[model samples]
Target chain A: MDKKLEVRDGSVVLKVNPEFYPLDIIYSAAYVFLDKAYVLLDGDLKKEILVKLQPKQKQDLEKLGGEFLNELINYADYKHRAAQTKTIREYLLQRALFTNDPSIIPDDDEEVDYNEILNELEEDDEELDDPEGIAVPWEEKYGQKDEKKD
Target chain B: MKKKIKLVLNKNFYDKKAISQAIKDFEHIAKITILDDEFGIELLQKEPLEEPLKEEFSNYVLGLMKNENII
Candidate 1:
């Protein structure tokens, strides 16, 4: 049940199962929605950094956070929070470029009018404060202990 | 012939709920523990063990597996 996947720096990880794939998938979804370029992080401690996505994108990501929680039993509690934060960063980039309503726009459009959704997209002041993204400190602290190998 | 069955588990399984679930997953499993978090997850071996079975042991184990949806 508690099989460790990787350990590096200050963290030890176990890959039981990913309860919520969409929280992670939303990053790509937002990129599609916003018609923007983005990258996902896999090196070092494992992080996601979005080069661009607007405030509205941030809001949309948070709203989707609940869907991640509801969709899977594995995401019912604290686990959902961390995945949601990473998704939001990427979503922000999608929010930055625009000229018209994205809902009505076709996916083939070369550009998005982020200005139009600027008002529709809510800004999360807390996210701006934490660029690294939000995760409970306990997951870091408890996840670090090297399990006793016998 | 009697054989020993060993099961390795995660530390989180040390928690009551996780432990109960794993034990219920296998009928012939005799012991489960967290020896190595990295590579010991599939350590459980199913084999016959010499032990007196209580009248309701199978039912009790089955019930736990059913509750955890591991059945």
Candidate 2:
């Protein structure tokens, strides 16, 4: 399979090939680290904000074992996109810490807050304006309809 | 932090005398609750508190069980 995406920096990178493994596998690994590897993370980066998997987090992948990594993606397929994303975020974030990649790893005493207020606003507007486009129902405004309705 | 999620395997992963050599293997990283009467071995792991991660791990274990035809 060809390189599907590359999360790169000066020293390290994760070159993903979608053909070899599904997207969920990549995502689940990331999610695992974000939740379990907090102690391995820089203290400054730990507080004040949620940490996301950096682009270059391939180094720590070995420790999780080949079976675990394989299981991650396989599980992602069994689960759903949201779950896979969290797992991928964890796996990637943990790898970033283990590898000591300065570019991706936040510095000590750094304060970062990830807020998507604009995204939320845009989403809200989209939901209001394009009723059919959104997946979730707007129960308050539009009465719930049976999903199997003809 | 991960919690021990129990999974029972249809066959035990051990032999009586040889198994005694390893102490840590018996101790589950997650949690192995064995149902002696049932035909399976239990595998466990700590689950992350994060909802999505928890669900993924849950599915991962469930997938393993399903894939292996354990349950």
| TM-score of only chain B in every candidate structure | 0.27, 0.29
DockQ of each: 0.01, 0.03
List the candidate 1 regions with Cα displacement exceeding 4 Å.
A1-117, A120-150, B4-13, B29-71
lDDT of 1 by residue, A8-73 (tens): 222222222323333333322323322221111122222322212222222443333333323334
Error of 1 at A137 (Å): 49
Per-residue lDDT tens digits for candidate 2, residues B2-22, read: 444443322221222222222
Query: What overall lDDT goes with each candidate model?
Result: 0.36, 0.38
As a whole number from 0 to 100, the lDDT of residue B23 in candidate 1 is 52
Lowest summed-lDDT stretch of 10 residues in model 1 chain B? B51-60
Off by over 4 Å in 2: A1-14, A37-61, A65-68, A76-150, B1-71
Tell me the deviation in Å of residue A71 in model 1.
28
lDDT of 2 at A73: 62
What is the C-alpha lDDT profile of model 2 across A9-59, one tens digit per residue? 321223333454444344345345443321111112112111122322334
Candidate 1 C-alpha lDDT tens digits along B1-71:
33433433223212345445555554455444444543233223445434322212222332343355442
